[model samples]
Target: MSLSQQRRFPRRRTSVGASRDFVTGVLIEWQLHSLIEDIELCVSELATNALLHGAPPGREFSVGLHRVEELVRLEVRDSGPGQPVVQCPDDDACSGRGLRLVRALADDFGINDHIVGKTVWLVFKAPAAPAPAPAPLTTPGSS
Candidate 1:
């Protein structure tokens, strides 16, 4: 089965934690334990970036999750003006590490630019499904 969900949040500092919690809850419901940690971290980074650089005044950002087969996709949309870029921060810098972390953690990462805003997306390759249990053997005349 496939599942998809999207949620919007105001451009606030709290939205970072809220986005992480939302992703954790959905991953738990979907039984994607293996991906919870990595995905949560990626979501947090993206959400924080959205709140810090992407969201304009009085505008909101959105997060979306889609699971189909052995892959899961995550997205964060913000009403910002510019596309996000990966930066090479100085060793002593305090900021500019979020996109780098996201790129390192996600299997695939990209930005979807629109006329109004942009959507930062990440894709993860889910764990393989477990093997089915073997059938029990029956005697010829057991019935």
Candidate 2:
């Protein structure tokens, strides 16, 4: 198994897009293409929430990626005070949809509170291993 690496960035609304791109790039680096889209979506939404409502402007945030035996965990940490409340929305509600989407996409999701900020985690099953390379074909009429 590959070792896990983590990244931290400032908590700015504009950073949401950048964070998603960063996570996608990391997934490519680790050759985890199957989980790229799901992870990117989750990371983007969670990071957006952290920047928009979870914390104040100019505060810092973090993104951590861990690859275990059969799962990959994505976490977005922010220096915000409040915990994420996942509420089911009515048909007319316009807001409070991010966490719901998180729960839907992630196999398992949760929140963790730190001394200063909080971390939102989303976990998905790791992609199945790529099929082994096929053996070279032999020619019947080889020289």
Candidate 3:
């Protein structure tokens, strides 16, 4: 099965959170509940990072989702400059753990440069199929 969805938002801190919630709702509506939390957090963190570092003023960002075969991908794009450097956030640092968390949760992830800004993508394995309904019980003397 394949599913795809996308949305764009202005580069703003509040928009990042709202976008996460919106995307999470979409995932749940599509019966991809298993991935809702993880993907939500990943998207939020990445978007927040983009807003903080990438978005300058009037730039915008986009989030795209693609379900191909047994894999689902979440991509966030922003109009900021320079690619994000995936580094280990120091213990004493106030921030910089966004990418680290993305790396930990996403099965496979990467950074891509776009004409305007950059896109950070994370791919996850689709959730297991729901078990089949059980057969009705039969009693020896019932029939």
Candidate 4:
């Protein structure tokens, strides 16, 4: 079965931590322990980006989680102009590497530009479902 959940956060700095917590809760509910770390990091980066650069004055952004079969998709949508890009900042630059992390950990990455804003999404390949336990071995003579 497929699963989906989403939340919208304001452009406040605290929203960054809130978004991380939100995603963590959802991942836990879905029993996706193996993916919590990477997904949390990605969500933090995206949410931070949205807060710092994407969210316009008095506007909010959204975070979404979706699972379909073996694939999980994470999305962050912001109502701001211009798309975010990964740039090679100077060594002295203390920031501007979040997208790079998203690119590295995510199995796939892409952005969808809408008329009003853009949605940056990351796709991860979920671990295969555990195989059912083998039927208990039995001897034909055993009643």
Candidate 5:
């Protein structure tokens, strides 16, 4: 079965934490524990970017998660005009490395622009479920 959810948060510093918590709860509900760490990191980065560069004062940004089969897709939408580009910041730079980190962690990353905003998305392959334990060994004559 596929799962999907979305939430909108105001453009504020706290929204980044809220976004991470929201994503974490959803992944847990969907039994996607294996992806929690990477997903949370990505969500934090994207949400921070949205609050910093995309949403204007009093505006809001959104986060969405969709899981179909073995693929999980995450999207962060904001009222920004330009798409995010990956940049190799200097070793001492404290900022500008979010997208680069995302690119390294996610299987695929891209941006989709709408008439009014843009959505930065990351796609990840979910870890395979463990095999069910073999049925207890049975002897033909055993009860």
Candidate 6:
């Protein structure tokens, strides 16, 4: 089965938490409860980056979630210039480590440059689908 959902968020400080909540709700609806924490963390970081660095004035950022079979993909898109970097800042620095943390948590991560902006995406392995139950056995004369 394949599922896809997306939502746009304004360029504001509050959007980071909104983005996390959005993805969490979607995951719960999809029955992927096991991934809520990791996915939520990634969404928060990416949304923060978008709000701070990527979302241009009057332009909105968007979050996309897609699931195909046992694979789930999360994406954050924005219309600002310059690509995001994974930096290993000094230990004392309180910020600039979001991308680095994302890289460590995601099973697969990459960037897609669009004509206007870019999309940062992360992939995760979802739990396998449950097996179907067997039909009840019946005796020769059973109804």
> Every model's Cα RMSD, please?
1.6, 2.9, 2.5, 1.0, 1.3, 1.9
Candidate 6: where are CA atoms >4 Å away? Answer: 133-143
The digit string of per-residue lDDT tens for model 4 on 30-135 reads 8888999999999999999998888998999999999999899999999999989988888899998899889999999999999998999999998988999999
Relative to the unseen true structure, what is the C-alpha lDDT of residue 10 in candidate 2, on a scale of 0 to 100? 80
Candidates' C-alpha lDDT:
0.93, 0.83, 0.86, 0.94, 0.94, 0.95
lDDT of 2 by residue, 33-138 (tens): 9888888888888888877877677777888898887788898888878878888889899887888897998899988888988889988888788789999898
Measured with C-alpha atoms, the lDDT of residue 140 in candidate 2 is 96
The true-versus-predicted C-alpha distance at residue 135 of model 6, in Å, is 5.7
lDDT of 3 by residue, 1-143 (tens): 78898888887778878878877877887778889989999998988887888877888888899888778899988888988877787799988788889999999999989898888999999877778999999989997
Off by over 4 Å in 2: 131-143
lDDT score, candidate 3, position 69: 75
lDDT of 3: 0.86
* Superior by lDDT: candidate 2 or candidate 5: 5
What is the per-residue lDDT of model 1 for residues 45-102, given as tens digits with 9 covering 90 to 100?
A: 9998998899998999999999989989999999899989999999999999999999
Worst 10 residues of 2 by lDDT: 2-11
Tens digits of lDDT, candidate 5, 1-143: 78899999998899999999999999999899999999999999999999888987879999999998899999999987777889999999989999999989999999999999999999999987788999989999999
Cα-based TM-score, every candidate:
0.93, 0.85, 0.87, 0.96, 0.93, 0.92
Ranked by lDDT, the better of candidates 1 and 3 is 1
Better of 2 and 6 by lDDT: 6
Candidate 4 — which pairs collide?
none
> How many angstroms is residue 79 displaced in model 4 relative to the true structure, after the best TM-score fit?
0.4
Global lDDT of model 6: 0.95
Q: If both were scored by TM-score, which would come out higher, candidate 3 or candidate 6? A: 6
Best by lDDT: 6
Off by over 4 Å in 5: 137-139
RMSD (Cα, Å) of model 5: 1.3
Candidate 4 or 3, higher TM-score: 4
Give the winner by TM-score: 4
